[model samples]
Target: MVIVGSTNPAKLEPVRRVFAEVFGGLEVRGVEVPSGVRVQPIGYEETFTGAHNRAKGALRTPGASWGLGLEAGVEFNDLGAWLFNVAVVLREDGRTGVARGGSVLLPPAVGERVRAGEELGPVMDELVGQKDTKKGPGAVGILTLARVERVEFWRHTLELALPPFLRPELYPLE
Candidate 1:
């Protein structure tokens, strides 16, 4: 069984979906556990910290043969606005694997608003003259979207990260 260090349906659901789709028919189980990490990550290490810590911590728990963690955060850029990236961590034994997805650019106005503590998604919604809608690349936005929702999009994002972590043959979006 692979235990995920997140209880958020937003994070867990996609991890499960993508893993299943990518590794279906394999004897793998997807389970959710609390990550104990904040949602809005602060810095570069924090970007990888929440997810890495969760996976490492989950391994300490009982009944977890494998541990996984997913973390997302916005990084300030010099251009205009910020960029959001998602990190995925998978661990078993002393070996650890990490995977990351492409970034989503946040508009400057929206980025500044979010920097003040407002939620990114909700704030972008208001600015785009919509409500409760995702701005920027959205769930599957900036990357490749196969007509999936935010959760499903996240699922694929993690899925993409997994292969690289698991095999030297796959080096990520290089």
Candidate 2:
């Protein structure tokens, strides 16, 4: 069985899809778990740590052989503050895999608010005048005009992370 770290449907759907496609017939379940990071992780380190922590925490679930975690955050670079997500997979045997999803440049105003201590979900909700856009099309979908839904964005990252698990010989369980 696979235990997902978040009960959010947005996150759970992707894990269900990806695991079904790859592992087949495995039961996928989402349970609420602490991310061990700020609600809005502002940097790569914190975002990655959140993902790892979630996966690790989910593995504690009974009868779970796999744990999945997906975390979204914003980071500023030379270009601008970009929103992205990181996915982490942890197995009962302690093997791990990680992959990062695509990023989108946030509007200056949005970045300002995020930097000033606001969560991206609420910021995006206000920008598009909607409620909980993060759990739906998300900022990427809103900015891209539905060209990329949040589920697909996260699925791509989860797919990438599976390579290590798929080919254990290629990725030694250091």
Candidate 3:
């Protein structure tokens, strides 16, 4: 079975779809878990740490053969603040894989709020006048006019992380 770290539908549904597509017939379940990082992780390193921590925590579940963690965060560079996601997959025997999702440039106003210490989900909710936007189409979907849904966006990243599992001979546990 595959255990996902977050109970959020946005995270769980994509993991379910991607794992089903790649591994076939695996049971997938979500369990709420602490990320061990700031609620709004600001940079790539911090975001990756959160994903890694959650994956490790989920792996401790008794029947989990694989643990999956997905985390989204924003990063500021000279150009602008970009929002992105990271996925970490951990196997029971300690083999692991990690991949990052594509980033979308946040609108200046949204970036400002996030930079000022607001979590992106709430900021997005306030901007879009909707509740729990993160668990649905997400900022990318909103910004891209549904050109990419949250599930599709995350599925690509999660699928990228599976190469290590698919070809274990090439990706020896490290």
Better of 1 and 2 by TM-score: 2
Error of 2 at 22 (Å): 0.7
What ranges in model 3 sit over 4 Å off? none
The models' CA-based lDDT, in order, is: 0.60, 0.92, 0.92
Instruction: Report the Cα lDDT for residue 93, model 2.
Output: 92
For every model shown, what is its TM-score relative to the native structure?
Answer: 0.68, 0.97, 0.97
40: Cα error in model 3, Å? 1.1
lDDT of 2 by residue, 1-174 (tens): 999999888899999998888889999999888999999998888999999999988999999999888999899988778999999999999899999888999999999899999999999999989999977988899999988888999999999898888999999976
Ordered by lDDT, highest first, the candidates read: 3, 2, 1
Query: In candidate 2, how many Å is residue 16 off?
Result: 0.8
lDDT for position 45 in model 2: 88
Model 2 ranges with Cα > 4 A deviation: none
